[model samples]
Target: LGNVRGKDWRIQTNVYGNGSTTRGREERYLVPFDPTEEPHRYSILWTPDYIIFYIDDVPIREVVRSDAMGGDFPSKPMSVYATIWDGSSWATSYGRIKINYKYAPYVSEFSDLVLRGCRVGPIQQVDSADRCAEAVEELMSADYALLTPRKRAAMRRFRERYTIYSFCYDQHRYGNVTFPDCDYVSSEHSRFGEWGDNKFPPKEVRRARRRSRKPSAVDDQPSK
Candidate 1:
């Protein structure tokens, strides 16, 4: 349930089991990234329908919300997170690359962060109900939240060249059952019951993959 800056220097869109799930789900989407080179601006845009992950403002990954997800979807209020540490025991390609102590005191910089989330005061329980106020709705509906042709192309190219790991194609891991948003996503990006092997003909052939086709329902129920 976190993005780890592995020794490979690749930014992976990885998520383990959500807090509500029993067996921790293991999945990751690899993208072209190198944090050691220079400062790169990473951004996250979360809407009711999906959460978009961007590197230097170019969209690279999307986590779509769906009815099939049940409690596994990250529906409750969450906070922004960042970390810099020595996860050498288990971070890089499953601990293949151990952190060298010679490069001690690892430093991670943060700047120009943009966060927009609703505040519903205190919640007494996990099952409390919630809704976005008009002001919050306006914020989430801003143009930055929508998709464009160029961004879609960037996402497709990134996925085509870089998405090395995906849960949708890991049939053996999930017992061959597609989880959550795969019905609409991997089936289009990947081969039939296989890993993502499709090539994009033209940018136009690639549909706006992340835009929520229908406006998300505002009435939300709370969970971890």
Candidate 2:
């Protein structure tokens, strides 16, 4: 699966393996600020145990690998890429909203690149995983790889305020079939309707949230 923006400009993180069309999952969220207005940090951290997606240093989503997941979790060498294109077919409103070329030359700039990993020639080599063992250990021990208690709380608050969709909780789409890696949280689950869409938080809760954080719920209007 690929990361893409929605018709309403919300960002989405997607993951899939062993046939994406049948087993892919996605999470959608709205950033606090206008991404187009300024440069912000976007990052993806993938390890053998878990994968984390971040925006401006804030951990937005994490997928923890589990034995029950089987081959659903991505477990192979991969390359990183960044680009901008018209994915009107599925990027926005399920293709109902086409990319209007009137605004030509849509540009996305990436810089100050940082990649951490052991380099190996090819996956066919039998010792590829063995050779990368040391690097994987070092990578897993890094500050970014481990989520502290404070960071976990931040992630929870961000999701409570900004998360719009989650495949793990989509009862209507996959009734009685919970994703193996899903860590069910009753409070979080209650926030989502049966269809997996977030039911807008109550007025009092929104007000309280606004008073507590810089990011307001007003900016989290879910896409139609």
> Candidate 2's residue-wise lDDT over 180-211, tens digit each?
77778898888888767778733333343333
The candidate that wins on lDDT is 2
Tell me the lDDT of model 1 at 38.
49
* Candidate 1 lDDT tens digits, 1-224: 12343322334564432455453334344333344544666777776677777766667677778777776766666656878766656445457766666766777787777667665455522433345655457766876566667566666655554454555665544665756665356445454234322233223211221221110111111222
Worst 10-residue stretch by lDDT in candidate 2? 213-222
Model 2: residues with Cα > 4 Å off, grouped in runs? 1-8, 122-127, 201-224
The residue pairs in collision within model 2 are none
* RMSD after CA superposition, every candidate: 10.2, 6.1
The list of candidate 1 runs beyond 4 A from truth reads: 1-8, 15-18, 21-33, 120-131, 183-224
Candidate 2 matches the true fold with a TM-score of 0.80
